[model samples]
Target: MHVTKEQIAGMGKFERANFINSLSGMKSANLIGTKSEHGVTNLALVSSVFHVGANPPLVGMLMRPHTVVRDTLQNIKDSGVYTINHVNEAMVEQAHQCSARYDSDKSEFEATGLEEQYFNDFAAPFVAQSNIKFAVEVREIQVLQLNQTELVIGEIVGVLSNKDYCLEDGYVDIQAAGSIAVSSLDSYHRTERIDRYSYAKPDEPLRSIWKTQS
Candidate 1:
């Protein structure tokens, strides 16, 4: 555990990757369930979904270098639209299966038991069981040369959720929604909201801490 990284590169590629994976944060990407140009459906698992700005409701996600093999990236490139499905404990198995390399003619929906549903005007299908889901239109794509990941920014057009999951101030309880997170490469976990706070400072009073006296 105390080994230096500079000394590890001499070990090998897999060793370097294993070291990085152990230290990385849990990144859960929103899988974009989409339809290809020829009507072939594509389920692409992504590792990057970030909230860029809230004014216009912008969100960002990155696709891997294999934009060539994944049709979801191409479909969004062509149609400028896609859906983001939240992965929960109940759906993680099926969602993870989507990361596999399937034939262009096969649909992840058909390949897996996970249900898919479409909206009135949107041609792409969204995960039917996702407690929190959104339809997004592609706004821009930025290619990062460092890793060849295409950072895609999108505008949320539609949102669907169970009414009970919403807070009085309009923030959805993602933990209550059962939205899960993706760990480094192939691991998934459920998130639990420990507390909801208004504001805080390092020196501020701590109300929740109980002091013990002997």
Candidate 2:
């Protein structure tokens, strides 16, 4: 199973892509919702969401190069707002179908049987089926010249989640929320609560703070 850089370059497109993407292991599966100025809604499944900073609560996601119409990116540029919704076990099928290149006028929420939700004055829609969702304001977009991929960074402005998913110490119980993760590009998996440990200090033994469910 050893693959060198030369071997990787020689591999077929699909094979090379799948292998490289899967090497990153599991990633958070999220549905990014946006709306055009004319009110057309778009939902796309993304797995590259990652934490950028916490002081200002920033999150970043990578969007594939614009080989075709990029409704989500365009909408965000036009409106400056979007929603990130976690995909759970029950929403896997619908969430995956979002990757299909539907007409820009078509709404994935309606096309895939997921309900659209709105809160406060957010300009984008949210997946009602998701237990954990948040709204963000577009902060910056950086285009990588090497690959032409776009890095979208947003500042989290609001959050909505099931009451049961919040812990007393301000942590989220993602496993209890039923959120799922993605491997490579297509495989979906349910996650389990392993263990949470306290911050490490010099001369102190690492300790687990996680509690087993009664």
Candidate 3:
């Protein structure tokens, strides 16, 4: 269980990738939807989506080296917009299939049988089966020199979710929405609430928000 840097560097490509990816434990699984300038729609499953800032409502995700045809990245660059749809329990299979490398001409929505949805003429598509989704506009794209991976940062412009899942305090109850998490490259998991606590103050006892709210 003691894997040194040398050992890690010497591991097989697939083995190293899985090991490194799983080291981060559970990750948010989302279906990134985009549309080519020519109007071809694309869907890609990405776990790297994360919050960047709250004031500007920014989000970011990493794209693997662009040595190959990256339809989602290209579409976002061309169209300047994309959708992030949470992969819920019901749509896990279809969402995972989106990771497949399909020809740019073929829409993953059609290939996977996932319904495409749009909001107010948004250029990108959303997964109709997802309980929670959001629209993002590209703000920046930086290439990480070390690995050639691209860091795509965007601003969240709109969100779609069931009202019941939106809590009073601005927290979205993703677990209640049946949103699932992914580990490594392929494993899927469901989560349970451990409890919520109030903001911590130095030397102050933590208060259980769940108990007070309930």
Q: Write the per-residue lDDT of candidate 3 for residues 1-214, one digit (tens) a residue.
A: 6999999999999999999999998999999999998889999999999999998999999998553239898988889999999999888999888888888899999999999998998889999999999999999999999988999999999999999998888988899999999999999999999999999999999988986664
**For every candidate structure, what is the RMSD over all alpha carbons to the true structure, in angstroms?**
4.5, 1.6, 1.2
Candidate 1's residue-wise lDDT over 97-179, tens digit each?
Answer: 88888888899888877788898899788989788989999999999989887888999989988988886667777887888
Best of the candidates, TM-score? 3
Question: In model 1, where do residues sit more than 4 Å from their true spots?
Answer: 11-15, 67-69, 201-203, 206-214
* Candidate 1, residue 205: lDDT: 64
CA shift at 193, candidate 2, in angstroms? 1.6
Pairs in steric clash, model 1:
28-182
Candidate lDDT scores, in order, read: 0.79, 0.91, 0.92
Instruction: Output the number of the lDDT-best candidate.
Output: 3
For each candidate, give its TM-score against the true structure: 0.87, 0.96, 0.97
Q: Candidate 3 at 66: error in angstroms? A: 2.9
State how far residue 212 of model 2 sits from its true place (Å).
8.1
